[model samples]
Target: MNAPVRRRRRRLPLNVLLGLGLATIVVAVAVLAPVIAPFDPMRMAAGPRLAAPSLAHLFGTDEFGRDLFSRVVRGAHLSLGIGLAAVVAGLAVGGLIGLVAAFAGRLVEAVLLRVIDLLYSFPDTLIALALVAFLGPGLVNATIAIAVSLVPFYARVAYSLAVAERAKPYVEAARLAGIGSGRLVRVHVMPNIGQSLIVMATLGFSSAILSAAGLSFLGLGVQPPSPEWGAILASGRNYITKAPWILIFPGLAICMTVLAFNLLGDSLRDLADPRRTAPQRAGA
Candidate 1:
């Protein structure tokens, strides 16, 4: 037991390290967009329109003759922000609902679970699209739509973990020791299930980013003139044959951001549930 524990604690997993490194770099670039961007992302130059990548324009110019590299750097701000915000909202609202429903009586659980099931029945993209259609298009509306669509997933995961935790002997012991219901949940239940939530949130971040991009691509998200990855991709579709750089760079950014979050989520899941070790060879 001691040997296994020591081995597990020896160093951080390679996936975690790589994920963290990539995520950190991307986040750093996003945060430093104002300082690092070479030119105004929105400013168009007639002379430079559709110029290829050069020393003057690293990622080249878009159809509008705006700096592609600068637009991409600035675009990270909106794309990453929306993704993180949506996931945070989903985790908070869904986690609370799950915990309350699981801890409350059967009637409450039944009602809440039914509502969740109803929401879950719709495909996530469809839900987002419907919400966006009703709410009208914009960054905030898109973020909210994406967040709402994701709530059921977080709630389901949290509910399952909370229900299992509630059935444990430790919870029974806590209750018998005169612990209040709220206190029991906050102190005993949440900590045990928090790791799972973190893993879920990490994975959800990637989903949120992808969903937001898709919505924007369809003109149901961030509008034009805004430096969003999806909006940029949509704008560049017309210029694909003439100037491919505009599409390639922003598309790569979205891919990289999603990949970073996914890798991080996988690493966190592995670390959280180390019990999922490979089966040993029989009679080795």
Candidate 2:
């Protein structure tokens, strides 16, 4: 029962440690893109048109003779930046609204639940597309759009966690101890449900990244000349028959990165929610 925590404190799974290290490296590259990238990510090189992978031009040259490796590296910056920003924004807004409704009472909870239901009825992609269309194309606007799409998911998760936490005897004890509703919620409910909110946020980040990339692929996000992953894919898509590496490398990057985050979120969610391991942990 205590082994998991002991393991975490002493030594954890190599995969988990390696995954964190990889994520950190990707983020570092994204942050230090201008300093780290070898060539101008945006500049088209006339001498290297459609060149295959070589020491001088790693990851090959795209149709426009642009450095494929440099753009992909820099694009990590755009995808991850927008993803973290949107997911954090969603978590902040949604977690608060959820906590408020869950603690308020029947009247407020019912109304808030109904609003969340309405948001849920719409497909997430639809909302993102609509937001980008209405707000016009830009990185900030696209981030906001994706973030708005993710709000209902976290809101629902937090609301559920709060409801269960409030019914616990400890929460009842707190209420009886003359604690005000606001302070009690802050001290008690928020701490208890913070794990669930974090798990939800990690997933929302992956989704936000994928959606933002889709928007960029369609020419709605970050705009051209920014060297986003999706834009790189878009630029080389037509050359798929002749130079597959152009599209394949960037596509693989997006897919693998999204998959890694999804796997990581699943593991963390398992670690955080004890109820998920009731049978296994109890037996072990």
Cα-based lDDT for every prediction: 0.86, 0.79
- Candidate 1 structure, TM-score to reference: 0.91
RMSD in Å for model 1:
5.5
**lDDT (10s digit) by residue, model 2, range 198-263:** 876766777888888889889888898888888888878888888889888889888767766665
For 91-192, candidate 1 gives per-residue lDDT tens digits of: 899899999899888999999999988987777778889999999999999999999988888888888889889999999999899998899989999999
- Candidate 2 stretches with Cα past 4 Å from truth are 1-15, 277-284
Best by TM-score: 1
Cα RMSD (Å) between model 2 and the true structure? Answer: 5.0
Candidate 2 lDDT (Cα, 0 to 1) = 0.79
Clashing residue pairs in candidate 1 are: none
